[model samples]
Target: MQNTRIILIGAGIGGLTAGLALQRRGFKVSVYEQAAQLGEVGAGLTLSPNATHALEAIGLGPDLAKLASRPARQAVLHYRTGDVLVDQERGDLPKKQYGADYYQIHRADLHDMLARAVQANDPTAIHLGHTFLGLTQNSDTVDVVFKNGARVTGDVVIGCDGIKSEVRAQLWGRVPPRFTGNIAWRGLVPMYRLPPGFKIEPASAAAVGHKHSMARYLIRNGTMLNYVAFAEKSGWETESWSVRSEVSELLEEFDDWHPSFKTFLAATPKDLCFKWAIHDRDPLPQWTKGRVSLLGDAAHPMLPFLGMGAATGIEDAVVLARAFQQAKSVAEALLRYENARRERTTFIQMASRAAQERLQGGKADGYTKKEHKNEEFLGLFSYNPATVAV
Candidate 1:
């Protein structure tokens, strides 16, 4: 297994994590990305205990602590009245309960961290500007072709490509991801730009309304506030994160929201506001076929309600590395990874949709802690992918 050459399609979080994990385990890994330059979008992501534990296993605990923020509290608020509907402690609570700390970090920071670590292991591990076209696999090896007229063969091919994965398309025709009728607008506000006496109590908060919701959290060492507003709409189907929108339009959409939310929106930089359509895919019946397999969004694209999309992908990367270490052959390793991950990823996929319904389907005033189904309430944080049965 030490001599096995692993090929990864896409250099997103999952792909980078997988590359780093495999390199740490003494496996030769290569990552191909479609972009000309390597960078993640300007966005914030929550790292639950499961994801933190997995990163810790790969020796990133200290680095993560430096770049991520630990929110002391979280809350659900009524959109109109700004009343806190439910509040929960998050700082030391997650560490005590799950044996790992929960974090909120900028997506680009985490991506850069993983990419740097992977490159440190092998300076030539990642190959950019190589758009994946397709692959042909046999009983012994898998040959991957790129649009740049580059062809590489490896013992295993892992499709970490995103929802519009060309690898997945080659394996099982082009199945379009279903847009969940939800459009989201995201923006970041510098902490200094807010009005005087503005409080960001309960460091992370979500304001729920009728058919609309907004979540805000501190990131980048509490110097920037990241917020995403969701609304069920139709006729707009673009899913690109770089699509910019007017701050005026954003304020118009939530004019009736609580004063605090409106204040945050007003302070957002015009260029920082981006709008995108949220899309998800049905769980695949299987993830592995012979020596090629799928990982992260390629296998199971998730809704953002539960904030587990990145976490699950990170978990997949860790378990995949573990599977390779325990299996005697490439085929067995792929099969083991598929079997160990299917159940958990599938559940999160379905549960995230359910969470969306709960957050947007009803009145915000009706929300209760007893009926809430978030990552914490669903026992997702308890999963220790580093030590789970892989």
Candidate 2:
């Protein structure tokens, strides 16, 4: 493994996390991100216990607590009329029962934390403005082709790239991510603008309701709440992140909803909210092909339901790092990493899809929050990466 190098494509939460994890494992890692800067768009991200375990392994757990919240109570579900469905206490339950605290933070905050960690830990390891185009692998080495027509050789390549990964296309052929028939509109609102009573309810700054199976949460230390608006159709003319998200479009969706919900939407700048097409890919037969493999959204893209996307990717970084820490050879480590993750990540992907359906209400399963006893939720959050992975 002399001069072993890990070329990670896509410097997202996964890619940069991989860089940090791999570096700690004694590998020279370089992360290539297409964006000119290392960052994420507006939105909220929930870090379940399991994911926090992974972050903790990378020394980010306590630091994250500063910019995020561990809700003293669990999620409370309500009907559109504000009738309480379930008021389950989540504080002692998830932490004591599951092992890790359920955390919610702004996507940008978490991104910034990880980005800074990568730079501090391994300076110049994450290079922005470089896009992955394809990859070529031999038995001993892999060469990553970038959009800029540059080729970097490494011991192996990991497609921590996102849903639209070029290396994934070259390895498994072009399998376009399928639209989940749902579009999520996300926005951020200042905490002061919210009604005082809008303290702890879904659809309000108080709660990230699951009625539409949409996700919303307060980030930036509760000074603001992130809103995610979702629907079960794709009437949108196009699907691109760069397209301007209109505020009126977001207003129309919650027109008849509660005043608290309305006020948050109104508070948003006309261009603040973003339209994101919920896209996902079928589980691949294998993530490793010779000396290159897939990671995160490139290997498994998912919807926002169950709030595990970022967590899962972070887990991938830890697992990948640990597998290499254990395996005898680099290629064998890739296979081991793929074996450890493919099935678990696949389950998460399908679980996210199912959650989307439950949130949409197009197909009702159980309305009572007590009945929604998330057996998987506890299992999903209770990952202790330090002991578990090693």
Candidate 3:
């Protein structure tokens, strides 16, 4: 089983982590990515203790600590008045409760770390520019064909190709992802560019309004601040993450927001503003079929309200490797992986949608910490995917 050849579609965070974890377990792994080069877009991601624990299990604890920022606290504030509605201590609390530290890191940094780790294990592990076209699996082996006319046969195939995965289309038939009637604008600002005395007290803050909200947190070791603003909208349906939006348009959209929001928006680089439509899919009955299975967004894409998208993907990678280690055969391993993950990921997917409504349904003035349904409050951080029974 240690010599089983695993072919992974998509070289995103989940795919890379899976490749690395399987390699560490002595499995011959190959990761195929659509892009010619390996890199992640400029954005910030929260690594809850659940995700941090998984990364630590894969030997990235030191590197993650170096590249990520640890927020001492997080708060939810009123969008118009800037009054704190919820304030939670985070510095040593997560470590004490979950046995791991919560971290905020640049997405690119984390992706690069995982990619490099996978490459270090086997220089030929990651195959670039191989767009996954489709696959054909029989009783014994799975054959994945790429657009570049390359066909590789492996013992097992895992699709970590993201929400718009071709692998998923071929497996489950094409089903359009449902747009959640929400649009988001994102930008990054250098901390030095902000006005003097500008502070993100509590380190991470989310300003909630009626049908709209904005969240910001420090990343890249406190040198950069990442912010994402959300608003309820309809009809506009382009979901590309690279779609640029005018800074003036963004300012006008949030014209009635608090003055501090405008200040942070003004500090953001005009060329760096981008917007994308949020989309998610209903939970599937299963993630595995024969020797092929799905992971990450490909398996269970969810709204970003809970900030657990990437964390769940990371968790999947760790548990998958563990499943392979314990199972007797490829079929057993795939079944174990899906059975272990389906219930949890499904719960998170549904809860994230509920959170979006709770946070943005009504006016922010009435919001309170007691009513918060965030990741920590939901007991999501307590899951150590690395040690969970798979």
Q: TM-score of each candidate?
A: 0.99, 0.92, 0.98
Q: How far is candidate 2 from the true structure (C-alpha RMSD, Å)?
A: 2.6
User: On residues 91-145, what C-alpha lDDT tens digit does candidate 1 reach at each position?
Assistant: 8999999999999999999999999999999999999999999898888989999
| Per-candidate local distance difference test | 0.91, 0.73, 0.90
Candidate 3 whole-model C-alpha lDDT, 0 to 1:
0.90
Candidate number that wins on lDDT, 2 or 3? 3
Mark the regions of model 2 whose C-alpha exceeds 4 Å error after superposition: 195-211, 362-366, 373-378
Instruction: Return whichever of 1 and 2 wins on lDDT.
Output: 1
What's the candidate order when arranged by decreasing lDDT? 1, 3, 2
Candidate 2 pairs with clashing backbones = 50-381, 74-90, 199-206, 201-206, 201-207, 212-359, 213-359
Superposed model 3: Cα runs more than 4 Å off: none
| Residue 287 miss distance in model 1 (angstroms) | 1.0
Cα lDDT of model 2 by residue, 223-254, tens digit? 87787777666565345555567788777776
Better of 1 and 2 by TM-score: 1
In Å, residue 288's CA in model 1 sits off its true spot by 1.0
